[model samples]
Target: GAGVSQSPSNKVTEKGKDVELRCDPISGHTALYWYRQRLGQGLEFLIYFQGNSAPDKSGLPSDRFSAERTGESVSTLTIQRTQQEDSAVYLCASSRDSYTGELFFGEGSRLTVL
Candidate 1:
């Protein structure tokens, strides 16, 4: 895809199970970010990866949540031992980062834990 694409736009999983969501960012972008939105709340930054720099995982909710990105390209988010409260929309965005703050976002991967 030319823009960011996320798999399984909607997912349903039982609590205590695990799920993996995927994302493909635009070509040539140097910055990629992951965020989680809980219901009506604003998007919360989860992690970010750029070039050869180290990833920032400070926003991860707990050990149950983790993500990875390969050089501003494809990325995956894994939620382990998911809980009902883990349900939310996972968003991915990428940008060229040439002194701009704009980030292109995917439709988002919606997960519902039952």
Candidate 2:
């Protein structure tokens, strides 16, 4: 993919169900981030992975949310026991490095929990 690619552009799941969103970043990008945006709200940082260093999971809303990345290629965000409040857009962004400040974002996965 030429840019950051996300899978399942839209997802509708029942409350308590689990969902997984995927992201494929641009080649050579070393920083990947996951964020959530509620309806009519701004993006909330969820997690950040920079190269082989420990992933910064500080922003995760709860223990039910988790993410993983393989090297610098792909990343997946998993939300377990979803709730109505979890219905939002899951966004993925990548940068050459955390210091660059410029990011490439994916189209995002819209999660609808009903």
> Which stretches of candidate 2 lie above 4 Å from their native place?
none
> Which ten residues in a row are the worst by lDDT in model 1?
48-57
lDDT tens digits, residue span 1-114, model 2: 689999989999999999999999999999999889998899999999997454578899999998989988899999999999999999999999999899899999999999
lDDT of each: 0.87, 0.92
Q: Against the correct fold, how does model 1 do in TM-score? A: 0.92
TM-score, every prediction: 0.92, 0.96
Give per-model CA RMSD: 1.5, 1.0
Q: Which ten residues in a row have the lowest lDDT in candidate 2?
A: 49-58
Evaluated with TM-score, which candidate comes out highest?
Answer: 2
